[model samples]
Target: MHELSITQSILDYSLSEAKKHGGVKIREIRLLLGPFSGIVPECIQMYMDLLAEGTIAQGVKIKATTLPLKVRCRDCGKESEITRRHIACPFCESLRLEILSSNDFIIDSLEVDTDGD
Candidate 1:
């Protein structure tokens, strides 16, 4: 799965961050994933666990937050989350809405621990 590569990238980035702080070890990583990001959270976690097997994040935790799906209607000038299959605008019943949200996969934050000097 590509999540392996994804986690590898995460590790690379996290390691860079650790370096910036005098090589402090990371305690956990938090991610924000939208519904339309097309990534399964469980799969990411599984891949992360495998990819981090021999890294500083070996015992770290990966947390994910799911974002909502929001759309904007072109005809009725409405913006909201829609999931009824009938993608028409709720105000004018026009299927001219365009997706406005639920299309992001991002790393939100990192928790690191630096030993006492």
Candidate 2:
């Protein structure tokens, strides 16, 4: 699954950052997942657990926040939140729409235990 690759990348980045900060173990990782990101949180968590096996990140907790889909109507200049099933503009019923958000996948923060306790 693609979640495996995503989890691997997250682990690699987290490990690198933790090393830079002299971290001994990773505790938590917070993520912001957009509605259009197409990544499943459950799969990511499962893959993270498997990938972290026997590593310093073992038992690390992964927390994700889902962002709603927001779109701006080009014709009426109105912004609205729409589900995946509906992407058209509600105000003017126009097909010309600009996606404002809900397409980003970002790692917001990480919590780690440093070596120097």
TM-score top scorer: 2
**Any idea what lDDT model 2 has?**
0.87
- Candidate with best lDDT: 2
Candidate 2, superposed: residue stretches over 4 Å from native: none
Locate the minimum summed-lDDT window of 10 residues in model 2: 97-106
User: In model 1, what is the error at residue 113, expressed in angstroms?
Assistant: 0.5
| CA displacement after TM-score superposition, residue 60 of candidate 1 (Å) | 1.5
Per-model TM values vs. the true structure: 0.78, 0.83
User: Residue by residue across 36-62, what tens digits does model 1's lDDT show?
Assistant: 676777777787777777767777788
Which residue pairs in candidate 2 collide?
Answer: none
lDDT of each: 0.76, 0.87
Q: How many clashing residue pairs appear in each of the predictions shown?
A: 0, 0
